[model samples]
Target: MTQESSRTPPVQDQAAPVSGEGAQAFTRAQVEELFLNAAREGDADLLTRFLAAGMDPNLRAEKGYTPLILATYNGHAQAAAVLLAHGAQPDLQDEKGATALAGVAFKGDVALARQLLDAGASVDVPNAVGRTPLMFAVMFGREPMARLLLEAGASPTLRDGEGLSAVDLAQRQGNTALAQDIRHAAQG
Candidate 1:
């Protein structure tokens, strides 16, 4: 058997003291792992269990990605909605200062983006590099996402750290169609 398969599971013996400090700490770690894993794997049921068990809705993984951000990055709309329902802040940024909306824009998940907007996420928030969600959407040719962000008040005129607006970035990326769309949105 593989080493992982050969390992024994933790005992749930009620006869033993559940309140032991070591046991309690181990259980807490396990619960945290479960919460992080649930977010990464898009396991809504496990996420619900952890949240109901008092796990923080805003808990971040080792890489600083919150449960909502993880779910949004993974395109787990249901899991993301669950996190939002449990008081998770939609605008919380990860280590890179990119929020869940940015991940949704990168992944071209219009539904997730809509959910984030409904939850009051800011469309104009920039990442560490000053690239807003609209810039990401345009650069990545996520036309629908670009439109959504525009509707949500993403400033196409806002420049990134490179001093390029979403239109300029889109044109530089050879996304002429997206550039045109951005221009139209800006003029309207």
Candidate 2:
């Protein structure tokens, strides 16, 4: 058995005292703030320790952004990975219906976007305005992010509330190359 397995105690204790507080729990808002800070600071070690200490991995901020979403938005790939491993839902959306993938795409962080996708983030999840990650990437002129989202199964043909597809948004932004790429993805 590995060291970690060896440290596992046999299930015999009837009632071991809970390590931290017993019945008195912090309010959901306070817990959310703590997790949000951990995510925003990119403190993977602190986040992991918090999770290990019985903190909920799915805790969300006031705006409905979970720790995983905030971590990805802040470019904390390691924190995001740790959260995912600890049962953070990759497809959870914020108040605006924007997923972590969409946040990373808007920031033009192709690597982070790839990481989110690999962690099971939805490429086609639409925001409040029916804008997918691809649409956000195109609208923001993030060509690299747009290409990455396309490769990861984002549909260029999906239209937003404005009746504009990702390609259309790219064209509106005057990004001809990105528009071309979106068109090619739609063709495929």
Candidate 3:
């Protein structure tokens, strides 16, 4: 059969094209290791110095975890906040598609989750299995995070690849109360 008329798909003429290579070039393993160390140690001054020296605030390790993610995971809230102020992509996902918000949510750190949210993380960005931050919060029975995500406009009805919604995940995790709360938020 004759091929359909050859036509280029419409490119979204929106934001400027991101220079992936240029961005990736600045993110070296050595810098990431140092940054992660500083974050783990909660050395805000050192972390700031490194960022000032042109080290990417969102540099990801081979495991796909970013500095912001590691900082929050390690309970370095201030460091994570500093990184956000330095242009770190709060929504940057690891190799497993887990964003900083998802990481903090799993840890039940409501404050860090809020920081990531305020930093402009997308509440709807799903992980590799389609689990959003809200899903993680609900699954972990983090009531505060669930409420925060709801207040931040997270959709409780959003489903993962397996058709599991946030409420469903909460129920599966034996959190009936959270499932009810999510349902209410979704309705609102």
**Whole-model lDDT per candidate:** 0.83, 0.80, 0.78
The digit string of per-residue lDDT tens for model 1 on 50-152 reads: 7776789998787788999988899898898789999999998888889999998998999989999999999999999999999889888898999889988
Q: Taking the tens digit of each residue's C-alpha lDDT, what string does model 3 give over 27-128?
A: 244445666788767777778877776777877676888888888888888898788889989888999999888888888888888888888889888998
| Order of quality (lDDT) | 1, 2, 3
**Candidate 3's C-alpha lDDT?**
0.78
TM-score of 1: 0.84
TM-score of each: 0.84, 0.83, 0.80
The lDDT leader among the candidates is: 1
Once fitted onto the true fold, the runs of candidate 3 whose alpha carbons sit more than 4 angstroms away are: 1-31
Candidate 2: residue 120 lDDT (0-100):
79
Q: Number of clashes in every candidate structure? A: 0, 0, 0
What are the root-mean-square deviations of the candidates from the true structure over C-alphas? 5.8, 6.7, 14.3
The TM-score, computed over Cα atoms with residue i paired to residue i, of candidate 3 is 0.80
Candidate 2 or 1, higher lDDT: 1
Q: What is the lDDT of residue 98 in candidate 1?
A: 95
